[model samples]
Target: MTKTAIVTGGGRGIGQAIVERLLQDGMNVVTCGRGAEPADLPEGAVWVQADVVTKDGIDAIMKAAGRVDVLVNNAGVQVEKSVADSTDADYDLVMDVNCRGVFNMCRAVLPQMSETGGSTVNIGSISGMVSDPSMALYNASKAFVHGLTRSIAVDHGPKVRCNAIRPGWIMTAMAEDGFALANDPKAAMADALARHPVGRFGEPGDIAKIVSWLASDEAPYVTGECITVDGGMTAASPLNPGLF
Candidate 1:
């Protein structure tokens, strides 16, 4: 039987890459976004005009995905503001999409998943494990994601496996936008690149490859693990060269 997988916010960037990779892996991929269907949506994949922030939106995605063998909670937002500088709107937007979206998706899909066993691959961030200056809300929300991943694995167990991938600095549209906002985009890019031991930033495909494996039966025993795929960035010390 062809397994169905639903990925949120898959119109472009990391989500698009994951959708493409999963399609290559031979799964019937169904993806959703808040706006209209994307013109460049991958071949052999379905896209629903939906969002993960609302119950109706989630229901729409569920209806589109018929049977959910895999769910990738990739719809997220970031607010680059210090805790003291953050506004209520910032908190709500970040929490609604990043944390609540994942929560709702997991809750909605897990029951159907329990019927025949399933898996969830959440796209988290290395910021969740550590601190990122001016990204207090994003960091906190991702932490919630990591914690929820563990809880889901523990509670759902062998029937529904759940895991999170905390990516470091994938050069996606969002990342590019962040860099573009920097005073010196080139210098910012260089600084970020220097932090990675790999001497390069990550690509969407890098994260997508892991998502493909984690969502497959090959990783049956890999539940509740929040794997970091950051080109060894987290393994290095804060005192390593550049900061000084």
Candidate 2:
């Protein structure tokens, strides 16, 4: 079947990569972001400017797309601050965008998808599984995503299949900034590259490929699972450090 997919936060980075991949795979794609759509978006996909954090915005996205077979909840934010330094508003913003945004989109799309049983891929983060020093808000929000994925898979099974993709250091702007934080962006990237047992950080395409597979018939038997794509960062231990 030539399926249609709705990708949230699809203007750039990982979401943009997912949108392109789905289109390349011959799926009709509807991509949305908080900012304006890109100028030269792929042919098979349409763009919308909508906030995933709001009910009305989500409703508008689904209404335009219609009967989505795949929903990739790839919208999220990063807040790099100590818990003590962060404010309640900052926490709420992160929760609203990262956690609540996914919820709104999923809840809105589920009814239509339930009729034919669709697939959902939530874009989670390694920060949730492994605590980072200065990213408490983002970490908690992603942890919520993982838990929500499991719950959805269990509750909506025999119809809808839900899963999460926890990405490591992918070469998106997010990673670029982390690199820039050091004296040399190139050196920081090199450091991460050395850390991955595979000897490289991931491309957005890496996560996109995994999510695409999960949303297709190939992954019919899979549900309620979090597949980590962190180059085994979480798997490495004190005694068994990965590549670095």
Candidate 3:
């Protein structure tokens, strides 16, 4: 039987890559986004116009994906501000999409998943494991995700496996926007690239491939784990000299 998978925020970037990868793996892919469906979404993928933070939105997605074997919680937003500069609105929006959205989707889907042995792959960030300056709210939100992923594994275990992927700096539109906001985009990009020992920043496909493994029978024993896909950015110490 063909399994159905639902991915949130699948219109672009890492989520889009994941949707494409899963379709290549031969699953029926249904994805959701808050805006009108993108013109370039993968040919075989189903796109639902919905948000993951609201009950109505979750309902709409679940309705589209009548029976889900895998759920990828990829919808997220970040506010580029320090705690002192962040507004209350920032706090609400960050938590609503990053934390509450995951909770809502899992709550709505886990019961059905529990019946037939499924998996959940949440797209967290390296920010969850380490602090990034001016990203305190986004950091905290991802930390919440890591914690919730573990709890879901403990509670719904022996069947449903839940895990998170913490990706490094991928060259997504969002990351490009971050660079554009810097005082010197070229220097900023070079500095960020130097941090990755691999000599290149990550691509969305790097993370998508791992999500494919963890959600499949290949990783049956992998649950409650937060896999870091950062191209060795976090493995190196800042003190390392330029090894050319």
Candidate 4:
């Protein structure tokens, strides 16, 4: 029988790539987001309009997709502000979508997944492992994701496997916009590219391929791991290009 997979925030970016990749892998994919399903979503995938931050939304997704064999928690938000400039509202919004949402989805799906073995792939970020300026809350939220992923692996192991993917500087719409907003878009982009030994930013497909592997039978022994898919951005220091 074909496995069933659910991908949150599948309307665009890495989530959409993951949905498409899973469909290519022959799994029945169910995608959810706060808005209507995008026209570009893969033809074979099912679209559920829901928000990950709310229990009602998560329930709606679970109700639409019964008995999930794989769950990809790709829904998240980012706020660019230092702690002094950040507001309580900013903290709440980021945490609600990034941390609480993951918790809610995992909680709702684990019981059903425990019945039969399954996997969960969370889309964390390199920001969780290292600090970045003007993104304090976003960093903290993803750190929570990494910690939660490990905890879930420990708690639900031998039945349900859990892991996280830490991507760096993916060329998504949000990332492009962030680049465009920089004082010198071209210079900023070039500097960012120089940090990665691969000489380019990551593509969504890079993350999708890893997610596919982690959820497959081939990765049965893999759990509680935070795999980095950053094109070597975090592997070395940006200041010491000669060291690499």
Candidate 5:
């Protein structure tokens, strides 16, 4: 029997990569995003147009994908604001999509998953582990995801496996916008690269490959872990240029 997988926010970026990789693995892939399907979405995967921020949206996903063998909670939003400048609306938007969205998806899918044994891979961030300037709400929301990942693994283990992947700085559309906002995009890119020991930013396929492996039977014993897929960014010391 072919397994089924659902990846949220899969129209582009890391989500799209995960969807494509899963399709290559021969799993039945279903992807969803808030808006219309992008032209770049992989051909074989099914596209379900829905947002992860609301119960109805997740329910729509469950209705379209029955008996999900794998669930990838990849939908997220980032609000670049300081703790003092952040507003309730900012918190609401970030938390609704990043934290509550994952919770709702797991709540909806775990029962069926428990019956047959499945994997839940949440796309977390390095922000959850470390703080950055003007990213208070975004950092906090990802922390919620990390903590929730552990709790779910503890609560539903031996049947449903739950884990998270913390991607460092993938070259996604969001990261490009961040780079373009800088005063000197070239210099900014160089500075970002220097921070990682690999001397390069991650590609979406870097994350997609790990997600595919985690969802496979080969990783049956792995659960409740937040794997960091950064190019040694977190491992390198900011003050030690020689470390790299």
Candidate 6:
């Protein structure tokens, strides 16, 4: 029988890739995002219009699509602000969407998962383990995802297994635009490649494959683990900050 998976932020970027992957794997995928739904979603993929930061939205999604075997908490936004520039509103916005959003999804879904004992992969970031300039809020938010994964694995074990995947710089539309706006996008991307031990940046497929493996019996022994799939960038950190 096919499985059921719910992935937030599935409208675009890494989340969209993951949603497509799960559908290709012959599972039912329920995806949600803020405001609009993807027009080109997979035939088997269900798109729900919802805001992850609110409890009512979370409830609506979970109630409409029941029994999820895999829950990917992939909805998040990065706030580029230094300590001096950050305000209370900025901090609240970051935590509310990235951290609290994950919590609400888990709470909405965990009861069903606890009984069935499935898998959950939280899309954390390498920033969760490390840090970057002007990204303290995003970094901290990802750290919360890692901590939350550990908590779920510990509390719901023998039934549910929770793991986190910390991704490096992934090539996506938003990232592409950001790089371009930063001046000399290709050079910037190339510079990043030089610093990374693997000598290249990552793609969405890189993360999607790892996530699929973690959710399968192939990684049965894995739980409460924060796996970094950054192409060896996290392997050594005497690396460059200019490209980060």
lDDT (0 to 1) per candidate: 0.91, 0.86, 0.92, 0.91, 0.90, 0.85
lDDT of 1 by residue, 1-244 (tens): 9889999989999999999999999999999989898999999899898879889998999998999999999998887789999999999999999999999999999888887899999999999988777789999999999999999999998899999999988988778766776789899888778878888899999999999999998998899999999998889876555766
Q: Is candidate 1 or candidate 2 better by TM-score?
A: 1
**Consecutive 10-residue window with the lowest summed lDDT within model 1:** 235-244
Runs in model 4 deviating more than 4 A are 240-244
TM-score of each: 0.95, 0.93, 0.96, 0.96, 0.95, 0.92
- Residues 15-39, candidate 3: write the lDDT tens digits: 9999999999999999999999999
lDDT of 6 by residue, 1-244 (tens): 5788998999877988898888888788899988677787767888899988898889878876787888899988877777789999999999999999999988888899889878999999988988866688988999999999999999999789999999988887745644664457688777767777777788998888988888777888999999998888767667584556
Error of 5 at 76 (Å): 0.7
Candidate 2 regions with alpha-carbon error over 4 angstroms = 179-188, 239-244
**Each model's total of backbone clashes:** 0, 0, 0, 0, 0, 1
- Candidate 1 lDDT at 55 equals 91
Pairs with steric clashes in candidate 5 = none
Superposed on all Cα atoms, the candidates' RMSDs to the truth, in angstroms, are 1.6, 2.1, 1.3, 1.6, 1.6, 2.7
Q: What is the lDDT of candidate 6?
A: 0.85
Query: Tens digit of lDDT per residue, candidate 2, span 33-60?
Result: 8887788676768888889887778878
Candidate 6 residue runs with Cα over 4 Å from true position: 174-187, 237-244
* Candidate 4 least-lDDT 10 residues: 235-244
Pairwise lDDT winner, candidates 2 and 4 = 4
